[model samples]
Target: MNFDAFLHSLTSSFTPVIDSSFNPEDYIHVDLSPSNALLNQVNLSSAEDIELFLENFLRQNQKKVAYGGYLEKRSIYDRSEHFSSGSSVQRRNIHLGMDVWCAANTSVLLPLDGKIHSVRNNKNFGDYGPTIIVEHQENEQTFYTLYGHLSLESLDRLNVGVKVVKGEKLGELGDATVNGNYAPHLHFQLIKDMHNHAGDYPGVCTKAELKFYSSNCPDPNTLLKIY
Candidate 1:
């Protein structure tokens, strides 16, 4: 099925990214684009700095959680070569996943029934630490869902080809030390074409390839239905 049909199917079946008790209203949509003033004030290079930013921002907004940052151009990637745009390839600044900011040990739930496709600990500054990609099938059309920035413990018993049900306990939100040194958050994404990549995928792409990447990775909100 196409992305539109896949999204429509969600109306009948889907799962929450967090606990069922969570309320959508409690989540504040955040902007990590270049135009955001807060980015200019805080040194995101330090995970602690991002943590501090999250704390103050959440308190001020009177919200318990902060989310968003899909397709956002982030300067935070400048910390490591993993997101390098200075080489032969074009500069990669646009983010491709939805980031959910919360407590360090908060649970990250599965959004659909699937089998464990791949798992890896992409240990690097500004990387996806302890990542997991689940392969799913809907109406005979297969797609994949990726969960990044997870606690190391989450992978202890995880293995490839293992079946996982919808809304299952996928993992917990990892701390900065194991979660690519960013603030505690979950980077959730949907991929129509993995391009043979396993255990890792480009969650961000250069502007030149935006057209293709955008179509490959549709807006996660289409399934999440949360702003």
Candidate 2:
């Protein structure tokens, strides 16, 4: 069944900022460019300092941290990875969702009232890291949302079939070690069917698979509306 409209109808309610009492909605939508705090500093010199800088910055600013499609779709993939050896254009795919780059303990809220269908630790570098999937119903239509790069402890308090309400704080984003082995960030994606699985879904898509993935994973901005 075509769920585009079902998905579109829910867009009007997504708040760009989680925990807005502490963090403002405007700050969540800002693009802090070239800041070492947001973008990783590339320095051939002092690799140790670079490591320290990422860890320190992540610790301090994981909350209120900002980065998005500053130029074109820079907030998303850079298209630097090789699809093959030498194919064609290095497709710089546009990012459909907003990323909340912050510390491990930053809390994530349930965007809407839903039931916990599945939860698992992806446990791979650059993976969802730790993930949660929720099945939600609005107007008798059922859909899902995937929350990735979450803290390990978040799963400790949850179980399958748990009922979560709108604006309820679900879990915190994990650290670099557990969160896909990169800088800490929340990889949130809204999905329709989830294809009857749990614990994970493709956070990134390839050029060849763009058409299918795009439809399968509709623009999160529809729900986020942060931009």
Which residue ranges in model 1 land beyond 4 Å of their true spot?
12-15, 87-89
- In model 1, how many backbone clashes occur? 0
Compared with the true structure, what per-residue lDDT tens digits does model 2 show for residues 112-177?
889998899987544577888888988888788888878889899999999998779989878767
TM-score for all predictions? 0.94, 0.72
Best-fitting candidate, measured by lDDT?
A: 1
> What is the Cα-based lDDT of residue 67 in candidate 2?
38
Q: Supply the global lDDT for candidate 2.
A: 0.63
Model 1 residue 136 CA deviation (Å) reads 0.6
Candidate 1 local lDDT, 1-227, one digit each (tens): 66756765675533469766678778898888779987899897788998999889999999988888888888888777877767635777789988889888898888788999999999977889999999999777888989999999988869999999887999898998899888899999989989999999989888888889889988888888774
> For all the candidates, what are their Cα RMSDs to the real structure?
1.8, 5.4
Worst 10 residues of 1 by lDDT: 7-16
